[model samples]
Target: MTGTLEIRGLGRNFGGLKALEDISVTLAPGEILGVIGPNGAGKTTLFNTISGVFRPSAGTVSLDGRIISRMRPDQIARLGVGRTFQSTTVFPETTVRETLERARSFLTAHSPMAWLGSFGQRAAGHSVDRVLKRIGLDGMADSEAISLAYGFQKILGIGMALVQRPRLLLMDEPAAGLNSSEKIEVTNLIRGIRDEYGIGILLVEHDMKMVMGLCDRVQVISYGRHVAIGTPEEVRTNSDVIDAYLGKDHELA
Candidate 1:
């Protein structure tokens, strides 16, 4: 279900200040687009704008050419866009299976308590089992959410989103706070999602190594503006990107 995503003339303002400015980018079906910027460079703001947390001051966002920029977050989510927050979003008290099943229930026809009512435990167990297998969490299905490692918890967030079978996933720092091995696990997981489920990804991350290693293309932002957009090699060699990250590391470029 992955399809193209287009952002045109996207801008967001906070009273006197502009958080994002005329940002435009496109992500093709089944492709991973990396977004990188220094702090306060409007990276997360752009994610918020696309994800509908903030209505853009101007412009349009489209998935498969369908406008969704100003839609409600839930509405956007239902239309095949799923997102994982920067911080862990799971409820610590819930079991791994319960977490994803609850998200699926809310996203579709069922309610959280519906599992307890008409469907009974049998149906609920099936639903939870399906999502756990989908995200490689089947082994931890019975584990408490609070008991899992932070990395798995992050994957569980993704599992919750996957239960909705979203077409485009906006991941905020998917590798943040992870050790090298965990980061590798996340990178592979992202690729597996794209390869197996046909989901396109828009990754907002600070791990330049991960971004450069995993992305099909990249967009760089500095001061609320896109300074470069291209292949990993092209962006890595760009003078502006070198200046933004490298400073005198431009010598390496």
Candidate 2:
């Protein structure tokens, strides 16, 4: 079944600081939803709450109609949710193929003994090869992850997530630190992940060009509260969104 993620009346607090307040959003199957806000708008906090890194102070998170707000991070991941950090997360010393194999191993077997078995080893290898091809890193399979260019390293992060065959992907600034050409490649890859693999995407990005071009719907937040939610064009012209986050000079055109 195509996966659906739903967050309802979610809130989070750090001591007296309310990081997120009554934030709610839904990601339907095969949809690409963008979340954007100025710094301290609670974007990362919201992601943490939904991804099970932090439990919400209030409200519930559900995946495919099952409650997941209280689940552990690994539990949520196993339930078809995958995520990438804003900062790069990769094993610098590991080869591309080895990294993907490790990710695949998580799905096939948890114990070292199980992974050492011939059947599990063969299965993980096959999955790793497929992920390498999917992320355009097949040629670099044997190369150390740290040896790749920055953009390719970011792509490898995506590949790591893909090896899990997730139903939903939460990307925190996939285009961050990327050059123009690299950003274009990432945009295409994100679209392909949604259209070809049927995975729903929830993207958090500061790059208006990518957000406006790639997202089907945009959600804007300010001071831990949702200010606007609509299509890219609608959000661009929205007075609340402009006043809260996007300035007048930030053209969506």
How many steric overlaps are in each model, in order?
Answer: 0, 0
lDDT of 2 at 4: 94
Candidate 1, residues 1-253: lDDT per residue as tens digits?
A: 3468899989999997898999999988789999988899999999999989999999999988889997998888888888874556457688887777777766665434454665655665675677677668899887887788889988888887787768889999999899989999889889888888777899998887789889999999988888999998998889888887646533321
Extract clashing residue pairs from model 1: none
Best by TM-score: 2
lDDT of 2 by residue, 1-253 (tens): 4589999999999999999999889999899999999999998888888899999999999999999999999889888889864445356688888877777667556544474688766766777787787778899899887788999989988988888778899998899999999999999999988887888999999899999999999999998998999999999989998899888767566
lDDT (Cα, 0-100) at 216 in candidate 2: 96
